[model samples]
Target: MSTPSPNTEQMTSQPAILDQTIGSRLKETVGQHPDRLAVKSTTLRLTYRELDEQSDALAAALQALGIQAGDRVACSLGTSIAHLLVIYACFKSGAILTSLNPSYTSQQVVSALRHVDVRCYIASSDILLPYKAPVSSSTLLKSVFAACDQDDGQVSVSSVIVVSNGAPNEQAIQDSRVWAFEGLLEAHRGRVVEPATKLHQDDTISLQFTSGTTSLPKAVALDHWSILNNANVVSHLWETTCEDVFVCTVPLYHTTGITALVLAAMLHGACLSMPCEAFNAQQMLRAVVEDRCTILHGVPTMFQAFVRLRYSPEFAAHDFSHIRTGFIGAAPIVSSLREKLNQQLNLSGIGNAYGMTETCPAVAVSTRKDPDEQKFYSVGRPIPHATVRIAARDDPHQTLNVGERGEVLVAGMLMKEYWGDPERTAAAITTTVSDDGIKTRWMHTGDEGVLDMQGFLTVTGRIKDIIIRGGENIYPPEVENVLMQCPGIESVAVVGIDDEAYGEVVGAFIVLTIGTVISLIEDTKSDCIDLRQTTGLQTANDASGSVVLTAAKAREWVRTRLSHHLVPKYIFLVDELPTTPTGKIEKHKLRTQGCAALAITGAIASER
Candidate 1:
């Protein structure tokens, strides 16, 4: 048995109740809830004791494979028990975990592997064509840990660790590196996994890739302190408690899911439930109702689907009485969607959160008690320990006043640098000296927003997404949110195009709900106009005689709701809008397509 280390002095300046290394804190949770269910899937349910024991065994196995501190281990596994084990093992071994999206094509996978130059891979056997480093040939790789077959007890490469409920791939499982992980667990002596050195608060723990608007992907490095601090901030801000049950259906590779849902659950001892498969609205609703989930964390798109599902009569029959709170982040939510959810689903409140992968995914978040106007207009104030300000690019000393838009600046509880990209790191942070010579620097958020007199931040739009409508400063997301409220519209994307009168005008592409018609015809002439029959016009057009529903109809719907100047001038029907790999609607690409379509139609205004 490993001897327990003596308690060390706490970092008085840092947040309390959270360890710099979550691995240690996780182990403590295991001790507290040894018999409680820690993970559950369709075919698996693991208690905390079993989870801890398995993690120890996996850590030992990794050590045997020559994995050590600072080593980069990449995983492209499914949402299974084994995948979680791999992540925990990496944590225990002090190795940085780089998560790869399983749906990525091989070329993309190759590019990521090359970018990170991973030292080892723990992948699922079912996913053929394992990820490879970009180098022409491998070097310094001790072995491959896979759920396939293992040949003899070879000391090095090409070894697989077959993992299945039933028959195993004996051939792939026989390699030296392909030791049976479960078998190793049976042999373990219940000793704690020991680390060569203690993990520092500043040491990198994980590298998450964020897709840039243009350039290649950036590896967002998050350290132990940043993660722990942000988790504390979010859990405290949302009032997550031990009694809360969080429904986490977003992919674990996504930043929001990892930092917000999974980590927060662990921090607060909240129960977490998510299926092995990707998110399905119907399945999620059923699970939430059955599990009595108290909290839900997801993107805006996911909630829109859930709202539509709730509109069905069949959905009203379920028992959703237990849901109390929900947090939506990583995307903008339309006010119409929020209102619909509140009216239909009984969701307690909707929080609009803003952050990036590098910041542990939370800087600002909304609350339930705020007035409807503030909730609709701005993301709430900065969470604890975060300092937010807006500064002009040309004059950092000139802090913008309330309602004046500028670059968002953040400091405290932020990452110190990006891994292996000093140039980008220097570009991201600014250093200044205080009167006493203490260095003060803040991170440039690359987003533009306005702060109200009360300090609430309203993100007008991304710096790159702003449209200078003859220097009027039009934000497409603000317009898109209004356009999405149109009665017949199912989805919308707004962008700006060049114009002579105005430097740019907003154009929207809309996807209408199925079964909408452009024209409604009636046989009034044959029926002698039936003026007497249609005398009660109020009841005659209950819903059937509504105006023809088209993209133009959608435009008219918004025309009545928003200012004439704010309404989009053109609306086009599209079966689908271009989306980013992470499922966000790609506005720039749609803008290009929209401009081309308008040009062909001769809708472009002549030089006037």
Candidate 2:
């Protein structure tokens, strides 16, 4: 349904929204701040002028390699300065850029590239190892490497360009069809390459694949109007400026890294700095202090990694005083983890943000100006020019009142389409015309949430993740929040386990904190079971190899805080939660694992 026709304030004051494309706007930043540091990695740094000229050289080389406007140029790269250069080159040359994670299996990479019919494939030789493995090693390697990815008619990749990390990769890249990245730059440098003369705001600039937790990932095509403007507006809202050194840990391939960190930095002339090519929690924090980085953004796991190491000898007395503001997102953040980050780290300006990959990743964010309580728990207000509301779970036309739990509906900053999949796109976005003749398209976010009277949005859980226990509905986060309050528990995931008597029951997977002990001192009258008795543990694989806590104590903790039905009937202490390539927890996998672990009989299921 169309949004309750945006009020006059939202309709009239969209001056924050820019009409220009990123390629042209970034050049303006070069002229405005020529000497400012633009992009930085541990080994490399480039000023705005240097970045502009280098991207220009790469743009010429890309066009020389037969890349045309609207052609898909795929880069199997990770978060590196070279990847950042390729981003600008594709933008400047008018080619639609597609980033593939280097760590993915060759089949996964080929499937995504073939889905878009990528015309030019660029990657470092190190990133090509997966594609060049022996025929017996990979299912898709029998055809060829980076060529003939799809069938005869479906494969459109014409050429492959190989980049070097720091040394010669010509020997590593022995393919006859490969072009050296250094050779192309030497030949094309100093050549003038003009931006696409007819670029439109609606033209797709970046094609990205979602993390696909429960199903196959979809390729999302994003336009300049939605992505670039969203970045610009958020930069303005975050008050990022040339003086800011924005240290980041999120992978550049994800939408949050590109739009919120990279594009935002370039648009505002802020220096986008990284600790290193690969993720290291300690190294990332060291960069924040050593480089005096003012802003840092990352997924929950990145922060969780640091929290796990915060008490080490090197990190115990570490200083985060130089850091001013940051963000926690891309996963559900329980209050326990939030409090650990807030109290132990002594970080003051950390806030929360919410959105999906399809929303170009930023719809609502809590700024530093927001109250610490609101910033910690809520995802703050709808971003500038974006409309957010809660609609009845089953009926999109029925808007729920403030504070009522429902599905979240967002109106702006959405992707153009699930590239080439109109049916899926139509299913995701709904269009309706208002009585005044204004047409607005709203995306149906499968997340359950509520907007408070102050306009702050608190995400509850995914609609698909709700557990039906007997006749009562239970949100996993509601139960998980209570479990996090348990003293020895570190992290938790709640899933619905199949039960013959109750249809479904709650099951929990827990990871304990360091040095935690599950004591039965209170149960002195009870006999202790043998250590070899793992059947009662209900474990799938105790990656820790030892269970420190008992299921009874963990279940008792939840039962005291939440409803009896909401208490977990089965609890498994896993070493770690299964996650997507991005940091989102995969609950569907947990459901399968939980089903296998649940050996509960009718007597156990009927327990009080």
Candidate 3:
């Protein structure tokens, strides 16, 4: 028999379309609200007119230096007015903007730069100093410092611009290809030139790197339409308006900060406030209170830090009544923590958004007006112009029922493609034809979730994060949620560890609340207990007898709330949970550490 022809009908279309790029939108806003406050940073503040004109000047300078359309310009600076300006400049000049986390080490930055084939490298003084020695001989530096020879094998950066407020680096000053950010602006003063190439809405605007938890970070190529439309939906969901002020607590490199916070704010003519160079709990809280910010955006860990600081005497003096709404995502949020955040942060409402860098970062988001249960427990319905469905883990063609747990499939406003990696992009995105002849290309989220009848989504866990022990599947978030209700537990992460008999078993790493104590009792069979006691076992032997006893209690705690197979067999107490730069608990790291700790303590043997 011959294979049947696939359906050619297209999936449902968006009700509305955005024809303009983010740069065009900025220009429109500038024309309408020239005097409106666009951004406020710790060191500088800019209005719409100033931001547009300044970015225009920088774009002219970059164009004069030979940057052209489709060329990639990488910014390795923290959240500042200069960073925002550079972003707009890249957009205005029709150059692709690639953001690198300022926290990245020199080696990591170099690897990223090589992968993206960056044309221009921009950084603040502090961020550039660390790379001066390592990248000194690279093409980027050789442009400025003729003494440094460039290697033909390396993908060389053409120009380097350092934004410095204090003393300029003598080395940077002497380099011919390098220029001070201030000098570039001064050089192009009053010279505003339009981009050489005409930009379309579908033109690639940015290449954002993923957090790279499981493997090397992939560069997601986002078009102007995807980003701008996604931001429009997110801003509307947050009830953002021209009168509101948004305080950004996340780094600009992340999707949550750029698409959801910065771009969303601009789309609605809302003011954006940068608390500090990076996320500082005190500084963020002060910004909220001082700027009278009506909205706030952060990951769960950032909000947790704020809650911790809320108890301090210094925090009591600050008034957070101005915070009307906030967003918490990029990690699992338990109900208990959600309640505490709403209360402590004085937020009238809180939203939970879910997406990856591949979807311009937001496919599903909970609105402020959603029911408490949905807002706190579920990552609400798909945003407008987007479609989401649950499919069987092993088969993409088989769609699951509303309540059945499966991999999440999203369509609409998806990334153009993963930059320079068509193989991986093809693997992540697949086309499916329905019985009715509707065809849709879905982005396989690789995340496990269940969609209820009301269309709300409950993300169970990552497909790889599921713990299968003795033929039973265990979702880590299910266990983590139950464990969070236990007293004295500040944060917890459940991971699967190798087991000789069961293939894999549940293991948990927990962080205790400050000042909470766990009493240790020496096991008579262990001779090292005495040595451990002398070495401050509380800080050192997190897998000691005391931890084992606490583990027993935790297992019991889970036993009452979850299935017997779901209870963690091994538990380790640590001062802090290992997290990525974006504040997500690094489960793979925990799995490695937990396996080693279990081997030394013979916890696996006990389980057997």
Candidate 4:
């Protein structure tokens, strides 16, 4: 057992709370700024009043189809104006809105539908094709349609609304339960309906799924109060105002895009511009320049891709002077890369936010006025209505002092529960008694971090990412941060592979930057010559002699910056790192691949 810190009492405190629902907030914003630009896509633009009226129409139509309060409505569409309308319509109907990534394969989509009892699924014509073609053959689709045909009390998908930008597909129209999105809108064009039940702050509003990297995704239930209050705090921290124009490049399926960017903009009456249906660095840059966008939000890799565009000759065609503040999250951001982004994008400040899907995503965020060092080194302080602490990793009951690395715990802002999974919910959140005898429930984040005296947080790594080598705990980020600064290294992920001598050993998978050259040693055989160093190669090539040489250099670089035990024992060169739909690196996949590669080479012991 670990010892509880003396300052544990001081670490626990309350933040201001606001009681509001997403629908009420939208109504308030429309009343305050009826003519303000609320949302914009490449071809469509909607003012506050226009958006509210359209959502009201859609809400009435949904009610006509038997959707009621607390019903689950899932949307599997790209990020567009239509997507936003569906989100607000669900809010007005008091329905729980759940989103599915359009990029998901048919089987993955079927799996998600099976996991949650979705009542109505909204998709674009492109996305609905797969389901409509084999409606009778697909067990999932047939079951859903059959349930709709009968008046059964069981909760099941009753309708699939297909949103088409142009003409509706004839094949899709053949299905009895399937309906065209435009027809639904036109049928109730001027109609509006009040929700059956009064909207409450505590009413569940969303069922977001976790990015299933290691296991199947779990449904996280978030209430109106948690999401609205969290968005209010995040927008305030970003200094968002009515005049701020935000360009959203992240997908709406993720909380970062919806709660943080979409709802935050709505809370402040700010304009939101969607650059494209999906993320495109050039399109995002063009949107910022064309729309005079003042704010931007994306993960680190998205920003990295945008910065790389600066090297293109056509980069001068767009002006980025209007961009002032933005948010970066979903992955680690190295200090050096952060500096380059700030310098290249000409951003006055870029904040780093930290949270999971369950927190409605922004528990902590940096301010525009924060120093460069703070922005680079920490994920800033907890937003209003949220508190954080570093608890002992092995013993959750014991809280650690400032600067001591341990599991990160959060309070105040949290999910209502994991939808229909009480056991998992109970495991993640725990009730604890502070030193003063006050009781509180903290979300046990499973992530490792340290807190500074100033209340800033530095996330070290995931608890699962810890490598236990020779009885010593080694965090991959510590070593990764160092290796990232080395020359020619583009991106790196470190994982633990099973070892005979040391229970587990560190393995690093590296992606080299374009144009990086690895000179061959004079004595190397003809077959061993570096064939992977072709200039202008855009994608990752097979592991060759050049990869071996680059890995050797990387090992030496780590030896100089970290302890001997911290250095990676094996290194593999790859084209790119596998990522979840949300852009987070999938380290578990790397561990499996790394172990297999090590075994094939018979280098488990010799590599060291």
The residue ranges of model 4 lying beyond 4 angstroms of the native Cα positions read 1-16, 128-155, 165-173, 211-214, 317-319, 434-438, 517-549, 603-608
Cα lDDT tens digits, model 1, 271-316, are: 7676644566777777787768877777777777788788577677
- Per-residue lDDT tens digits for candidate 3, residues 506-547, read 887777765444434432211112112213444324544332
- Candidate 1, residue 215: lDDT: 55
- Candidate 2 lDDT, 237-343, residue by residue in tens: 67788998887688777788888888989988899876666676777877777778888787777788878778888778876766677678887787777888778
Instruction: Let me know the TM-score candidate 1 reaches against the reference structure.
Output: 0.82
Tens-place lDDT digits, model 4, residues 314-431: 6756557777787888888887788888777776477888999877777677767777788888887777677788888788888787779999998887988988889988988989
* Runs with alpha carbons beyond 4 Å of true place in candidate 1: 1-19, 126-191, 498-503, 518-547, 563-565, 596-608
What range of 10 consecutive residues in model 2 has the weakest lDDT sum?
524-533
Positional deviation of 349 in candidate 3, in angstroms?
Answer: 0.6
Q: How many residue pairs clash in each candidate?
A: 11, 0, 4, 1
Candidate number with the higher lDDT (2 or 3): 3
| Cα-based lDDT at residue 176, candidate 1 | 51
Per-candidate alpha-carbon RMSD to the true structure: 10.2, 5.2, 5.6, 5.1
Q: Would you list the C-alpha lDDT of every candidate in the order shown? A: 0.65, 0.75, 0.77, 0.77
Residue 336 error, candidate 3, Å: 1.2
